[model samples]
Target: MPIFRPYDTPRDGAPVLAAGGVSRRRLPLNFSEEDLPLFEDALEAAIPQTRLLELEDVGVSPEGMLFKDWRILPESFSSPSIMEQFLDRRRSVLKFLAANYLLRRRRKFGRDCLWIVDDWSAGYFHWLADALSRLYVARDAAKDLVLLLPHRYRQLEFVQSSLKAFAVGSVEYAGAGEVYFCRKLFMPSHVAPSGNYNEEVVRGLREMLVGFYGREGAGSGAGERVYLSRGRAPKRKVSNEGELLDTLREFDFRVVHFEDHPFEEQVRIAAGARVLVSNHGAGLTNILFMNPGGRVLELRRRDERERNWFFNLASATGLEYFYQLCDPENPDEGPHTANLIVDPQLFRENIRLMLAG
Candidate 1:
């Protein structure tokens, strides 16, 4: 008869041990009893009722967040010393095996999972590969691993490339999945536009707003977001400010030329506006925090160097969105290289649709 293990279907059963026929040698390392309980608590929350075989101290930082290495230890290796020594060993092989074992266990237990790792980005993916290769296993079980990227696409490509290099079989990217690998899957409670502000951060913001804007304006707060802008007049090559001014005026918005302010103040300003507008860039990411029905008027480059990520965000939150494409022709270059001018009619229509919606 086949061994009936909980790991066969990731969705069912407990996380199992994956030793690959080799017995594990535990390492000796000390962890404060208080810290151990806290870690155990987190593990329980992440994987309820799942058995954990503490193997080693995975990594540590000044912030006091301990990344422990764990595997589903078989009954024979249940002795704490197996985990103790695993912590002390610095050899790459031991570390690699420890991670693989734990990951294999997680895969066997949880069918679909969301990993909210603190900013591992693509670097975390590389570690997954290393752990698998050391054990001579190079297959990903049929599951989706979505990474929550702290930075934009350009910044994380290196890690993306590394994952591609290590992938043995076919694995496809899921644009939107039930789970995602990210520092955060949704806006923090403090940033959430709701009456019940349970999070300490959100409560703090509420208190600050009460002090700053009083109850009326503060009561209208949705989510806090930082806005960035070039403070000075746009140089000729930097942006077409004249065209932007004309187009913005057509939409009944008075262009406010200002320097970068503190993050809190920026959010405060955005909260007061019916529509927030900006060039295609990072500053626009703040729109993610806006309340549903709020509008984002983006000025996209005519060359299409930038693409809107609002598709996912809009789908997630019912926010009204519009963009005015700006084509900057290089007068010094040939006619073929010249950019198309902004279509004023398109700009007006987008604004009208947003209001109508």
Candidate 2:
């Protein structure tokens, strides 16, 4: 039996591609002065430097767990702390042991390969902001390497369209329940922490995707006003969405259900939006495609203050960030997944202020 290390051995000489810096969140227009202390840390945070390293004889599990020399790599998990907790739980030790030792059936890639797939790669927001951001950072290095992804992602339209947009040359997928052994793995450090973002890398991603999908003179007007609807989702819906939709219509906001459209259409819609309104959800991730100086008004649950993913995104992409806290229809359902009950009057006031600026 072998023990797992939270991270790989420090590669002090790893190539640093992008330098880290401070990222500041622009407070919402109607932000309360009394709550400033609640968001002080997230208001300004340090971004980590991006690095590219080469690892030999690395083994990757189906969930994108990376291990070499009996030590797990931090890149396999969302963060090192999460890896520590995973080890604490001891739930996957037998599987890990089997994959590294007794698992005789393994797929071998005998070339310089790039591994950007992670546990969260299936989600749209993480796919764009996390996985693709790594690919963008390793664009030059990946030219000659085979990009490895999970087989399940092969059929996702956004995944295919985005890879095509990036013009990634070589790609191969590792099957489920199979351990992959790469002779030489070219791994790029995450562009930034989970919620924190790196301005340069994010802006670079936006420019690349927008260039691929943006049409001439499209989204160039005062810009399209958009309201993203989460009506199809099982939870976290706007309980008073009908009244809000009426208000949104008054402002000429186009109601968009992102799932109804294709990936390219979503990109175009995002590129054209000068103003975007949505409850806190993955749909807001499209802000990455909007032009700089655009505005976003997020409807948040009053108790859910710490999840600042969209706020950090807006800051990174130069979008005006605004928010209105609403009460939860089912407070017992918890903050992240609770349905929101918004006051139409407050929403109107916030919209007016957002548009005026």
Candidate 3:
């Protein structure tokens, strides 16, 4: 059976885990734990259990919350407070929802389903945290389950390969239909808008990932040092990539860019590392494959100060994660897409400490 930890559905039981609470108040309410934001919505759809009702119209529902229920999920630590800032411009959620929004398209599904919507289909980071774990939630009923996605996901090499490993065949995309329905629809809670990565999300996803990582084999490339490079970003180039690479090579670090290779190849390479080091980029998500007790040193952009995504991933996978803030290309300027510069001495010292551990 597919695994989703606290939100996992069972083979012979109610689809609705618990009846949710309701609210008429808006944001910033002093909410107790029992009074969840998505509870009422979940209750509305879950009341008629064993029912598959289809409406004549199907687009963004009037609710305006595609996956809000996930925040209230038992296994999720995300709470109603998050709803306050989720639609904010700074939150990536706004862009993600806008990108996946169906303007003049519709589709249908044949079984119970779920979807985790995002634009970066090929991004390993998005896959590990949102896409892949959401699949585990829907996989329990594979015979009668359909996963919805944008057409772009079909084009991604990692997306296709990951689906095959789990024997997943039921999938769909958005476009061109007046009526669309499903037996059950689950949209995983990314809760990305909030910069925090709580324990539940970490442990739950990691549990599902362990099986997939099993193929890497024991003691594969033991004590290997891998540096994930970000020389390919369209705008955020690593200005000191050459110097960093030269320094890392001196320590026997093998350089690899996840974007350069197929998804499986990337995982295969990441699986063997004892020390994985790189600038803060999507490739570091591969740290999920490394054996526990492995180490990660992330070179973060001082100006941008990104969310604690990989650090949480490392925590979940039992890898030791370390990070150092590096100056941006133009320190005087305001925030924009930018590269990073790491002090060579500082990085080498950190590497030395990592190896000693």
Candidate 4:
């Protein structure tokens, strides 16, 4: 049965593990009355129920696609809205058909398994904020539940450490170019809409992670400022980072690259930050670990005002949020991937204002 509108479909037989409701977020400090309409939908969005779906004889792909009897299950993709937003319809259809029809090798598992992998599970930001957050809802079953993951994901250190922290029973990997058939599959609905957050669930997950990995007295002290650098990134490079770094240094800011550190180390570094400064990117996702009331300064592209993932997160986590709009080096490259140019003088002004309050 192909579910085209999984969001509207009633949970006739599925059990509601975590109830859903509406949540409100405070607007970013820089937001004005004119920008209210732009964020109207997000300011108070409805969170979806975290329900458990029990399916028999379901075929699972390495990319987290699920199907039964050669038919796709839209709910397995998280939500129909996310599918339409991030995936190419024609390409997805072709891939699904090829996986079920052309692929011959299939591995069958008779034991019930829990599947949480999704299309965006590979990326660091989505892995933590979206994929792993689902565990919070399914935590009640974490004791003996076997998590199914892609073959390559089994080698990622962060993934391994996170699973350990969650106390998941065991893990199974789905091989590339082959579909695994599960006799019984246990899947959970998304805890929140993609890029949106549920404060209680998200904060709870963050606390659990910190409690497990956090070191005592790590990155401690007031007036401890940190700058997350995107210097190694292919796109979204800060053209004038050297100049910006010089100014940041005057204020005792320590610049670091999150990619260089282990998952636990990243948590420790973020734990003591009184202020965090970084361009709008995945590195900012670490704000979830920071102490509440800490300030966040996001160097956002002027045209990319609607991408408020970090803003909403700061609010949900009880952090004060602020943003400084920077110009893209090449506007033709587009807001999402274009390099940015930060004005050091403007940054100084913003920093002073942030510290004053």
| Number of the top lDDT candidate | 2
Per-residue accuracy of model 4 over 137-183 as CA lDDT, tens digit each:
78778667778887789788888777878767788888876778899
Total clashing pairs for each candidate? 15, 0, 1, 0
Which ranges in model 3 have alpha carbons more than 4 Å from their true place? 1-110, 118-123, 176-179, 187-223, 303-306, 332-336
Work out candidate 1's RMSD over C-alphas: 20.9
lDDT of each residue in 1-357, candidate 1, tens digit only: 111111121223323322212111111012234333222321211111211122222221211112322222212122235434543454643454444443322211122322222222233222221221211121232123332222232244333432343323333232221111222111100111111111222223223332443222455543222222433533322243454455555556644433344434444555455566665544454444355566666655544421333322332334465555566555454322333355656655655665564
lDDT of each: 0.33, 0.83, 0.54, 0.79
lDDT of 4 at 216: 31
The 10 consecutive residues of candidate 3 with the worst lDDT sum are 44-53
What local lDDT does model 4 show for residue 78?
49
Return the TM-score for candidate 3, rounded to 2 decimals: 0.66
Query: What lDDT does model 4 reach?
Result: 0.79
RMSD of 3: 11.6
Candidate 2 at 280: error in angstroms? 0.4
Of models 3 and 4, which has the larger TM-score?
4
Q: Which residue pairs does candidate 2 place in steric collision? A: none
Tens digits of lDDT, candidate 3, 1-357: 111112322234335321222212121112224433322322221111121212221232212223222221221223344433443333455343343354324344445555554443346566666556545444554445466665556676777776765655567754422224444565444433322233344344454445564434346564388888778776555688777766787788887767787766666677668888887766777787776788889777764433555655665567776766678887765434667888888888788878776
